[model samples]
Target: MVRKPVVSGMFYEDNADKLSSQIEDSFHSEFGPGKLPSKKRTREIFGVISPHAGYQFSGPGAAWAYREIAESRPADTYVMLGISHSGFPSCTSLEDWETPLGTVKVDKAFQAAFMERSGLKQDETAHSQEHSIEVQLPFLQFVNKEYKDQLKIAPIIISEEQRCKEIALSIAETIKQTGKKAVIIASSDFTHYGMNYGFFPFQDNVRENMHNLDKGAIEHIKSLDADKFMGYIDDTGATICGRLPVAAAISACRILGAKKAKMLQYYTSGDITHDYSSAVGYGSLVIE
Candidate 1:
């Protein structure tokens, strides 16, 4: 029953009514394709990689994945691996994510398995204000009606560490061992823009390098090559905060017999707001 509020009212609407409507509107707005291959080629998805930014910025990209989930309506459980902004030393942190809609329960059985597999301690304190995962709930409420009562999540907050892959692999293995229907959601935002975020290598320009960098990294992800992905991160220093989660999800999908990934949508806030000086990148990808 421990609930965390994280990025409430800032990343998303705080009010339930407003949040619900906004998410619905965003879901309806997704259209067109991107640098990735057509979605018509990929199989049904086991899960998705989505941005956790505000509704105005990344909501549409996030919705493409959720919309696929809604249309398919997969069963079993959901495990959301999100970035830990708390700077905790923990390899993985787990807790219940709360929003105006309702509390999404933690699947205790899966949680116990994850704890044993990852050997990571639970820190409810870290989950209290971690926005990365919590922001996705309102969209879930919009997409999945069955989620209202049965929704359960294994919320894991990952940190930057030498053994990130070890922890990620263990968590993924635990999910596989469960032998139940489930979906893995990775919450992440690609590239923070402007000097305030200190990653202005492009100097607020809408050049192709920014897009290419993300495309290359995402290509590695699509191939389910975690080692190559880690190498890319080391080489390019791409500013994706949820790399760990995406890595874990890709690994888990491969283990679960998922063959490939398809990019559903990609966009930057600049495309919507006409402010290239500072923008956050958003993308949606699915593994089948």
Candidate 2:
């Protein structure tokens, strides 16, 4: 079964040529303020954090991370931990995902091993309408175009924090046991502020406050402290949509012997729209 994209033409371009062009543009586009970390191609990246939003809004930020993955030469499979935006509970899908670029085959062998180790059930409906995972496919498609045949995906929907850690550990064990090289992609977006998300935590300096809050969370990620990352979100009531997914990826990376992380880029939607009244933050990071 092929899982058709639900967000194409809405969150990103639907036409194949247009989508490819848009992604290429994002790669060359100038990222927001602050000097981006220098891309080190020799270091092996264990995982990455990419934002899930409209391509125009967060594409440039995401490109920084994907560019690193492409430059480093990724493994055969990618374990994508995405938030359940469809309000569904946690689940995993074992179906090929169809994007405008092409169809990405699901790693059924890896999925089966993961399920046996993690005891997570396969629920196709859980991924039916979710946009978080769908939004990241184009980036992967563009980066792995040369090795598309070798690239397979294991898409998992993350919900609860504790459950995410447990599943992540299982994922690590499976990778170790199978001896299959895989990279984890944690699909997430930072703080969603203002009345739109009903998560306005500050009255003054909203933009700066949002950046600080997101930076604090990013620091935890940089340290590979999954517990501290989740705790920071709870303590500050930061409206990070994919906190669980990020925590899961961090924990998994830690188990996989990842010791360092670097922030690639950070920006908010407000920077583009010039409307600080309602904003959503986006960030990219690479864990190695």
lDDT of 1 at 51: 89
Give the whole-model CA lDDT for all candidates, comma-separated: 0.75, 0.88
Q: Model 2, which residues run further than 4 Å from truth?
A: 32-43
The clash number for model 1 is: 0
In model 1, which range of ten residues has the least summed lDDT? Answer: 32-41
Residue 103 in candidate 2, Cα distance off native in Å? 0.5
Q: How large is the C-alpha RMSD of every model relative to the true structure?
A: 3.7, 2.3
Assess candidate 1 and give its lDDT. Answer: 0.75
lDDT of 1 by residue, 254-285 (tens): 77788888888877777787776777778889
Off by over 4 Å in 1: 30-44, 91-95, 204-207
lDDT by residue (1-288, candidate 2, tens digit) is 899999999999999999998887787776732233244445578989999999999889889878877777568789999988768878899999999999999999999999999888899999989998899888998888878887799999988766877888988998897788888999999999999899987889888898999999999999999889889988999998999988889899999999978998998999878888999999999999
